[model samples]
Target: MWITYFFSSLLRFISVVFYGEITTDFKPCIEFFYAETIPQGISGDYQALCQHYENQYHFATLYDRNRRIPLFSAYILSPGDGPRPKNTNWMIEPRLVSDKVNTGMEYQKHPDQNVKNSQAVNEDYKHSGYTRGHLAPSGHQQTEEDKEATFTLTNIAPQMEKFNNGPWNNLEDEMAERFKVCTSKMYVITGVMPYEKDEPKINNRVTVPEYFWTAYCCPTFTAGPDQNYFPTYAAVGRNDPNSKDDIVKKNTQDGHDVKEMSLEDLEKILQNRLKMPEMSLFKNKCKE
Candidate 1:
């Protein structure tokens, strides 16, 4: 899983993330991206992962190794055909912390010594008052393996319980419902917006996102024009209950809120916060 990207840096070094095996090309999980084209606008300390499990490519995750959180996860919309996995058991992305990973992901119970230093281990979230929220939610997957593949820590970020269980959960559910009526393949990219600087971390490990976001692109919809959210739609939810309501108003009883808007607006907000003026969610051809 050697991932080399075109993004440049001060060091002028090519961005690369080595996984279990050497990959000669970038198409390890290209099917996850819209038009087989990765989204742009993110630069700095990031690694792209072709998330694999049980000898299968499940999705793609652009991870921030420095922040120890996924920048975003891209996947095809596949609603689960069975009930959710009971008693979730989280796992670790081996390549983030090491160059050779025979297994794509492994249980975090007894992680390697340097594992805690390179990535977030199970211990990081313990007693941290933050939930291990999924960027690629398990419910969005159809098979048992795909759902279980999402348990890897590489696809997780620290999320407040109220925000995770409230508005965030609702947004995921809504996406599932929308997928049911889609005529074309739905490409979903779910991610987070980190604070401008000095962001909070869980147990001094994983960065807690300021906002959780998700957007989807389905060019053709059987649901018709009025109900069609294709070829793009987006939403962002507040992770901090005490934060101001300028972006997402506190609409729930315990003060959780989600704001649904056009995909462009979400990109605008990310650009401002990330200072990466071109912050975007999908490729140029993802829309009409």
Candidate 2:
């Protein structure tokens, strides 16, 4: 119940970017991202496709004005509701938002429950002591269907009250600014954590991010060997920066640097090296 008011600016920006309304289809579960690419590290039901929007659309914007990047999550969704592909060979996991794996904790018992209301604005949840988090914000989601698909829990992550509005929020601002100045498009992802290894512990149960990262390419810019048009993006969360580990103590200060890589290379590193099953612009090198 104890929350900080420092991240007010960042939360404001997230409210704007993650703003707008999501209408439910009355189904017990709404399909989110279509699993355009399977995550490499974790194991479970996996799918890959655009989550929201369609081809070549600018994602929602939350103005942070500091780090210049959008603090949001996104996915590509497959069109319509059909039986998801079933394949054990698939590397990534397809997930349901309400599933136990997707939601770190039980919704009813968690410090913050995911709320679905178009009428609720950013300020509504800003000072709740919980981060005004995004289940999905926008990046590669280019269609109305895709956007709606991103509303699922598969895309959400644990965030902080301060970082969500502090340096973390600034990252979003920096990315948006770069997008405008370069007149380029980028696919971005962002997340938050409950605490650092050294920080005073909060509740005995809240999970924190060991690390986080995002991947993007500017088609207008240089096309790498992979033929993806965006610039290689590299950014990691507060916890870990090494490409492999997730233990809290390993995630320390001196923010991880961003690196450019191809989609294939990204996939390989994620699968074999980093040990995480998902595709994110951020990565942490786990020490052997």
Candidate 3:
């Protein structure tokens, strides 16, 4: 047992060095971020990126080195009220800018090819027929700085305009409302699921996801009849209107179907889709 434990520890240490350490800013909130089984082939390059702004960690992103896009972003919803700040200018991650592992500038000249760097710039999304969807929404942020931190391209994905502006936007607003009523902090993880086959790419730079998912854990809340359901909630939204209803059925109001479910069910969907047999968004499923 001791030998096995030592090897496991060694392997984790090696992974950090190869993938780069989780940014210092995220150290305090690391427990809230979950572990994901990176898809095959990109294991060595997957990075745990902490979106830092003004010297503080606003959110955490699991970035794919091969796709040059974020797999997911995790953040804690702080207490806040009123309208969200205006959309800030998109910026490239400075950590990605400094990483040597993300070299290869050939794709910059060819927009049709996949970009294999750590950072994504505005040009990549221009005229891409998709909205720069936020994984960690600014509306959940309490401070202006935190809101601005969410504008980084690393925190965005190529989402259909209809989905981005419609149901998906509504889901974000609903989450903000839920967070407002919670007595304690809420930890949220939002991510995208890639298509099983024939994945679409925008500008041939970033892969477009087929579905968008979000799960939140509010460990502390005012006790009531809904206490059983109060601490955890999750939902998945279809990003592709053309796709069938195998994952989530489309709603009548809008083509972008958004379905809310328990956190466990959402984890099951993620496990099957991500090929991670034991995918848990919260530490020990956020049990007390």
Candidate 4:
């Protein structure tokens, strides 16, 4: 029964992705992965500055001076237009700037590919010894192909377990519920933020999420894009208690004792925290 519902959704999804209603020229970035099954259309590699998971997947990480957080796209698997996964926990990392020739199982380091000298750290942010945390959990992947795509670096964010489980986990929960009812095909994007100018800019490829959001249109659930359902999203962690903003900078930079969020809060929390437009589309569907 579940498989039946899953495939039904898959058919609907494929129809939209392959030949849906959008008349725009927007084309998704595509990368191929070699695994047991065909994976999502777009996936990223990890930044070279990162200490772990470099050889696993492709990521996309671009530094934005204006916006404290790095802009990022989450990993998506093609599900072959089937029922949504009973699971949606997959860790994602943003890809760093690299040439096509150096990606995907090719280890040739591009001369320019080493984490740009400008962005590379020089001890300001200390090794902190912490592993960049992933909001999307890879454990949910059912196939090797799905797992491979989840391995991308673009999907990752430097995070502590306390933060990942606390308010951040809340935001992910909200996103999952919103997706469940979404009838239109959709794509989600999330990124991390760094401290304001002067907090010793950590060049260590570490990231803090200033906010996160996603958007999609599945007319099946509505006659048109239902901004109310799963609009764009933006969410910030509670400011550190010490910093007046209540945001937690880094509790244990030593990297020992990783924190895990509550398994139960993972879903609904994402929905509640994400702001409406951040949850909806950039432009009103009617306007578009």
Candidate 5:
């Protein structure tokens, strides 16, 4: 037992140094952030995830176990070399349910009582009229395992059908294209904004978000076509058609379109809408 434990610890350390996984810490997965920095001013009932899958760390997510959804997912933008994974074998993080469980994510099998009670499961989303939207979308991933890793329920939120398939997905495609031309690494953080009060839920479990938001900070980059902005950019899209046309406007398809803005402006909007006195998504807004 002791020998087995030693090797496991050794291997985990190697992963942290070489692959940039943060498995054991109060702030999990700092390696996923640029300059080892995390977003500030977020509080109230959340868990940070290293996003381990198939013995690898794919990204980072700040999960709300109470709401059974991710507040945000942060990852280094890859060139997205191949097609999206066809498999829908979504997964779950066992550590979220029990700290004693020491393993990477596992396939989302039948939801036992503890698993069902602790987090959202496949049944919670079955016929729930909402798609299992990914906070770190698979399309942004370069490898098959990383793409598959994004399917974990902990990194997912309940998204509207048209919104996910339409504007939101389109935004992802555009970001991918923009990232392809960049000469340096780009760190992207995608997240959702829940209603300030009496948030809605699906299957009485997973909380649905009112709006989806994403931002990227590229400290240094070679300019692509139609390029003027640098360092950081952001956008927010409406998940509800009935929402007011302020941050994002209505489109012809009876849905809201994505609106891009400066990273600083986006933080102010999040601070106001989420009711936090202050909010910052990146360290120095990625100035350094």
Candidate 6:
């Protein structure tokens, strides 16, 4: 079976190189962003959200079909300067609605096997008292195309305005600065955790998250006194301002609560909450 699979893959590669197209009997939903790792045991239907520009994957997301939002978005940080793009237009993924929607064969299987069309649009946030939070922030992107790709609704979730503009924004800025100094590639994964009680939904469309979590791994960095901490870092921020200080303490002055911890510690918390004892965000925890 292994030999057959290997030759089949080889043939596909060769066909693509010569014919500019390759046919397959069965093709799995390819998750381009999970080159490092993908979380486990997330209920509800999920589809890989890939934003392609110029025949390349600009960024990827794990979109939740039921909730009409992204569970997480992953991207590699690139260095750039100057003001970021502001004219981003939020758009829905048509392929998520139907496989026949001409997405350049991005979805190989039936559309039902992919994300459902929950129709989460910009108007859903209107008068809903929530912000359109970006899991993969545009600020981290280097090119205009990459930055614009982050504007898709599939890459956003419902978040409190305070949390989105306050502590969460600060965390993203810090990450950008850190990535600028890293000697090697840095992979960042940002996601949200559902509320334990009274889960809120915006406009009866998008479910609001309780906590927003982020983790980054920089396998290579400049040697420093804190070299051990340079490789990886994890953090969780509170999205509900009124929620108790169980996971993340409330910071009244800052308008949001955020706590930084080790990647291992974050994984342990996720294991219990996500009910996946083997949940790993980074491949082998980004071990050297």
TM-scores, all candidates, are: 0.88, 0.39, 0.80, 0.45, 0.88, 0.80
RMSD to native for every prediction? 4.9, 17.2, 5.9, 15.1, 7.5, 8.0
Q: Score candidate 1 by TM-score against the native.
A: 0.88
Best by lDDT: 5
Worst 10 residues of 5 by lDDT: 17-26
lDDT of each: 0.80, 0.34, 0.72, 0.35, 0.81, 0.71
RMSD of 5: 7.5
Worst 10 residues of 6 by lDDT: 20-29
lDDT per residue for candidate 3 within 1-288, as digits (tens), equals: 999999999987765543334434356447445332222211234666756677677778887666666888888877355566664566765556465433211113332222325456678788888888999988888888778778877788889998998888998887777776678778888988888889988777688899999988887787765566667889999999877787788766566989989988988888788665356567656655
Error of 1 at 62 (Å): 1.2
Clashes of each: 1, 67, 0, 64, 0, 0
TM-score winner between candidates 4 and 5: 5
Expressed as tens digits, the lDDT of each residue in 169-208 for candidate 4 is 5655555555555554334434443344443223534445
Shift of residue 135 alpha carbon in model 1, Å: 0.5
Error of 5 at 196 (Å): 2.4
Give the per-residue lDDT digits (tens) of candidate 5, residues 57-145: 89998778888898889998885677878866878888888878778788856768888777889888889899988889888887988
Residue 162 of candidate 4: its Cα lDDT?
Answer: 54
lDDT of 1 by residue, 1-288 (tens): 123333344224322222211122238888887887677656666777889899989999888888999888999988868877887788888787765765687786788778877788888899999999999988999899999989989999999998898778988998888887788889999999888677998777688888888889887777664374667899989888766776788777776689999898888888787677475567773664
Name the runs in model 6 displaced over 4 angstroms: 1-44, 104-116, 225-228, 253-255
